[model samples]
Target chain A: MTATAVRAPARRAEKPSSSPRRRISKRNFFARLSLALPAAVVVVPLLAIIVVQGIDLVTHAENLTRPGSADKFIGWGNFTRAFSDPDLLGSIRVTLTYVVAGVGLEMIIGVGIALLLNGRIPGKGVIRAVILIPMVLTPVVAGLMWRLLLDPTSGFVNYLLGVVGLGNDHAFLSDPATALPAIIMVEIWQNTPFVVIIVLAGLESLDPSPFEAAELDGARGFGLLKNVTLPMLGPVLAVVLLLRIIDAVKTFALVNTMTQGGPGTSTLTISNYVYRTGFQTFDIGYSTTLGLIVSVALLILIFPTAGRLMGLRIRRSRG
Target chain B: MKRRPAAVAVRSIVVYIFVLWCIAPIIWLVSTSLKSDVDAFSPTPVWFFIPQFENYVNAWVDGGMGQSMLISTAVGCASAILGITAGLPLAYLTTQIWPPESTGSSRATLAILLLTIVPPVLSLTPFYRALFGVGLTGNAFGLTIIHTFYAILLAVLIFRSFLVNFPREIREAALIDGLGEWRALLSTILPNVWGAMAATFVLALIQSWNEFLYALVLTNGDSQTVPVTIAGFLSFFGTNWARLTAAGVIGALPIVIFAIVVRKHMARGLSFGGVK
Candidate 1:
């Protein structure tokens, strides 16, 4: 496996006769110390803060108002409160919808475009460069740019729609019905290129022998794609899908900039909900509880997905 | 096999439509930035008119984006440097120094990767409280530290992956030639990984430049970055579309140019250095 190869260098003790004897030498000690020191300074404090705050909030609900106060203990109170809250529940639903819809649309469109451009096309280089513009633009700027075009009055979107005989009165960001979809559209526009670039890379690296054989056996058009390409592309697609889903779940900047979770909380993702609760409302205990929940949920989801992706990467490299 | 002319025409049309879709919003942004207020708000879109370069002047001067631009650049550079300083060693230690199959090194790598997976928004309040405790709230150095933490994940991953693929014979030859571990890393390994390092640094810089939540939450007043400053335009001038678009254009120009310059590295970096 490529994973084993990646780790093989470390496993091979350099000059075994020298390794054991020299491993603890002054130079080796300093190297290890250098690594340990920074890791400790950064990772230790971060973990300590998360763990301490999480435990403190769960045990002492009174710390909600004044964090680190550590007053009377109320076991499970914050967790129970979070579970019963309608807003938090709504945020979970909203985030799931956004993640599924945003990732789904991106995968479909990204792969389609990647497949189209994968052929011997003209201007492929220029098209790839232009498509990358949205990905590189600041999320805040992207949201603001969309706001300009999506503005109800004197906006290009409405003007163009009116010219085409479609109604121009729709307030894309202001109406609850259209607000979430509008945000999803922005997310797709910016991130779809990410999928394109990644999948295109995967597509390029694929071996041609299988496709050649399939063609000789009369695989054509949809049949070739269905029987030959897609199956071979499975691992790569899985990796892309997982990464996009994880990234999409953390969607905040666009929502914050464009909608502010507005039009009656239609776009309030769990991230925004946690931000509002902890900072705006200053309910530290409940917010920390919610934050812990989000962290745990993501950890569970990411561990398996990341492991599989890494395994696949190792296998691909080895092959 | 020769393709049908009809199919070829259809493919070209699809590619053109996709390219148009990708660039149209950006084109509109640039066009609006150069349009006069009246022209920008015309009932029918202004497809052709004399470009007004004064809007950029107004946005930079009147909008106070000039100061924010300087701050953003400083933070980006500072954080990227710090990220590399801390991340390179950690990555090298995990992948090259320590036994890779060892539980300690693997766990350490996992922990670092996990730090990245956790939503940054969850850490916002905690980081704010911690930084505020040390009087780091609204401080440029504090903002840089926050950005450094963010950049570390990318730096470590890219470095580790690159090192994993690096040829070991050269390192072993150097070690056999009486080179100290530190000397070997600096003299032998570092030069070889320059490509990955440069890519990591640029990616980190762009990320710091584009970061919004921390900048919005952690910095205020003179510490505000361009993204925050551009967002301020919305609240500051409710409907000044010309100036707002101008501000957006000015703010995005540097990164856009940087991205183009490093388009090759970026194509690799976007896939977490896996593709290249």
Candidate 2:
């Protein structure tokens, strides 16, 4: 426009021109172009990859048409098959059980520790950081650490068990019955502080006056906690629970590292199964459908948990 | 009040115990790394040993972590650079592009947030196949792109969080200076956000350095990174404990030291929302 303005002509009777309008237009174009760069570089590839995969899924429908390939799909039929598959069904049951047990244990232990450390605990800051170490430690590292400690041969766990005269050297990770439970235990050990942190936020948000007021009314101890304390904590607790459930449901880290979904399908969470199909079995179509199922399953569990958490928060604040 | 002191002591001891549980394994690995092969595997599980440079030396030279470290570092830097290049402007555009005071259209953030939670593994299947086709399946450059995607999502989140604090006047001033949109962003906005950009970069660096599964599946050769070096310490049949622990210590030490050094920004990055 400015280049054209110079070309257009003999209309300028003013003695001086600042060219403010020209500068502003240049700036707008520059800002828009630069700003668009960041999003373009990142999102374009992702969208491209997803689109390519989508095409692959569609084009390969025949290969996945039940008898043609091991993946067993004819377009949306794969998704329906994934839902009806007994292995997937079993995985859902197993995964839910693991989530409930693992996260439930974490909540109890985390809340207990938080309450214990709620006030004038010695080295509280150090303790708080220490408690968070598990969260920071990679699941692979934790798995390796536990693997060494739990190996029936020279593991520290066996050594400790030997010391206590409960000296049955258990092959924990390889045992079908014990494998999933062992993973749950490891998850509890690692993630309990995640619960503690959230609950600690609830605890931190507390005003001592309410507890004192409750004390004045002959409400004390468990009753005080049940009434004043727990209610105040309901929102945070809801968030914590929802967080734990989401984490637990999607949890593949410790399980993959520890068991690799072994001894049967006993340790096979939806994640591991999908991974097995895609990477280990090299069945893209089957795995995509399986992966899609896992995401849906996660969504199903997550939304209800989120709703419950929000509802619990809302209702607790009503009084 | 007097009884409370005793309670405090008890709690302190408990806290110390838990801390010990957390740190002890890593400590033991480091200690073992410092020892000779005989001392590392003693029935006593040697709690104390004089530090030696052999394990680390072997890890770097003989164990081939030097090469892997280079790959990891290069990949990390590339990812960070790519991520910030893409994320900063996108974040600014999304935040500043729209009319701020509007209703029913604040969903740019919500969309990005959803991407953050979407497991990277979900994309892995496609990435694996796609990379295989493009001959990037086991390439360092390919891994860089994957990390770049992961880092961009996170970097955008970080920048977007800070964008709330940006002086709109700076943008306005750039406009007044006759700078075009791109030039204004490059000359004015990026300079201001450099600190945040560097912070996000460091975080993404650490994340890429520590990442396992993607690297596990992606790279196969001299291209592979640090975590691969660490995992390779474990033999398929297991119980090469001495070498494995040594490798683990070697692989993790630099990152640990780096983390400790940058811990102030590190804390802010992790609990980015807690301050407000």
Candidate 3:
């Protein structure tokens, strides 16, 4: 059923070949142009920026901070400096930690909640609505709210911790040891719902015959879940993981608002590092280099995953 | 299939606990917004207090959030509009006009989608440099143009997925009646995809509204949006919990309402129609 639905459009696209070849070519030319025009409008400026920045980085000509600065050639200097910069390298490590921790927790908790919600439940609509609140709230506001909640002196979170006999003065955001963890906690709290929603959607759309067959074969509870449900959910989980990793790698707003990459740059993700470099320090050349590095990293990470997703879709369409 | 009472009871408990976990911080925010400055800052948790409605007034008036709200709304709407207008035609071209299996259009679509992975921080300086060169810095319209670029990826992805699944028979029928591809798209095809369009628009609007980095770097003073302004309150007010919480609530209010209103389309939109 799923395969056919996926293939229906592909089949239709192949059907018009009997028409006059000239007419088809004309239509295709006009259509392609229309599509390419909008794409160019968006992509051209971005490409120009990247190319210009790339040239500037290599030549060391323009100071992006000051308008109309003269160009001077400085080959590979920014890249070399960026490689040796402890802060940039440290930010990369911090970003890796955040991406791994944030995406991992969100996946586990999100899938767990999704399974729980997949069962017949009362007030499911209300529950789903409530869960989506954090996902919808502005990240800046969410970060601020967490900052308020995690305040050392008057925070509700610390108050609850004290009530439960956990130490309350941890100063989660201010202290270096606990700051990254605190930011990760807030990230998980806000984004776990996204995973829940996506996983739940997948759950709802799943084929039920396998579960029924598993039940008839004496499978129940965790056995059925592990054997029947999870196998079917593999593709959905892959897509969700891809999305979450991309989002997690871009963590900036929360860190900026809550910790300001503070207590000596412990919480500085690569994005925040780049922002500080470009805006605060005004090292436009180095910042652009850092940006390019991040872009390269993202491309390496995403290309394989995107290709896998494309393969999955094509297989579905073909089957 | 008989259900066990114990299992059902445990599930209910888990569900309610999860709901409370999701909502607790928001409840605390609202409570803080309603507390007096002294009560808000009390070392002990303030469970009960007379609701301070005046905090909303103070935040809205004195905090400059009203102007921010107006600016955010205008930016969100303008970007969503431009994004849709540009994105839909491009999606239509990729899905319907170009052959689906062809390398050209699919490659273009993939390239566009890949653009999303490029961290916005990387583009900020160049965007800043370009906008400054054009004298568009700190202008809402300039910010809108930048946002439109950001929004295009979402718009194209959602609309392309939707148009791919759109029935081809309708387009064929419209074509037999002598309509051009553009006309058929506008007249026959677009109406059928209103739900998809709405989903795309809402997603884009919420993104533009919630966006902080660009809004922070690009706009200043009167053109500042709510997120930037609220962040500003932290530096300017320095632990004024009452006004800050109130401002936070006000800043989050519009998107929250919008989210609920379009709750049904959200999962589909967020997943880029993958799950749905």
| Candidate with the greatest TM-score versus the true structure | 3
> Model 1 shows how many backbone clashes?
0
Give each prediction's DockQ, rounded to 2 decimals: 0.54, 0.31, 0.56
Residues B160-248, candidate 1: write the lDDT tens digits: 76776566667668777878666778888788878787888888999899988788888888889999899998899887888999999
Candidate 3 structure quality by residue, lDDT tens digits, A113-185: 8988887778999988888899989999999999999999999888889989997776988789999999999
Q: Write the per-residue lDDT of candidate 3 for residues B5-27, one digit (tens) a residue.
A: 78767877887887888899999
User: What is the TM-score (0 to 1) of candidate 2?
Assistant: 0.79
Model 3 TM-score, all chains together: 0.94
Task: List runs of model 1 lying over 4 Å from the truth.
Answer: A1-27, A53-75, B1-5, B99-102
**What TM-score does each prediction get for chain A alone?**
0.88, 0.78, 0.90
**Model number with the top DockQ:** 3
TM-score: model 1 vs. ground truth = 0.93
Each prediction's whole-model lDDT (CA): 0.79, 0.67, 0.83
Residue pairs that clash (backbone atoms under 3 angstroms), model 3: A59-A74, A61-A71, A61-A72
Say which docking band candidate 3 falls in.
medium
RMSD of each: 2.7, 8.8, 2.6
| lDDT sort, best first | 3, 1, 2
lDDT of 2: 0.67
Task: Please report the candidate that would top lDDT against the real structure.
Answer: 3
lDDT of 3 at A158: 88
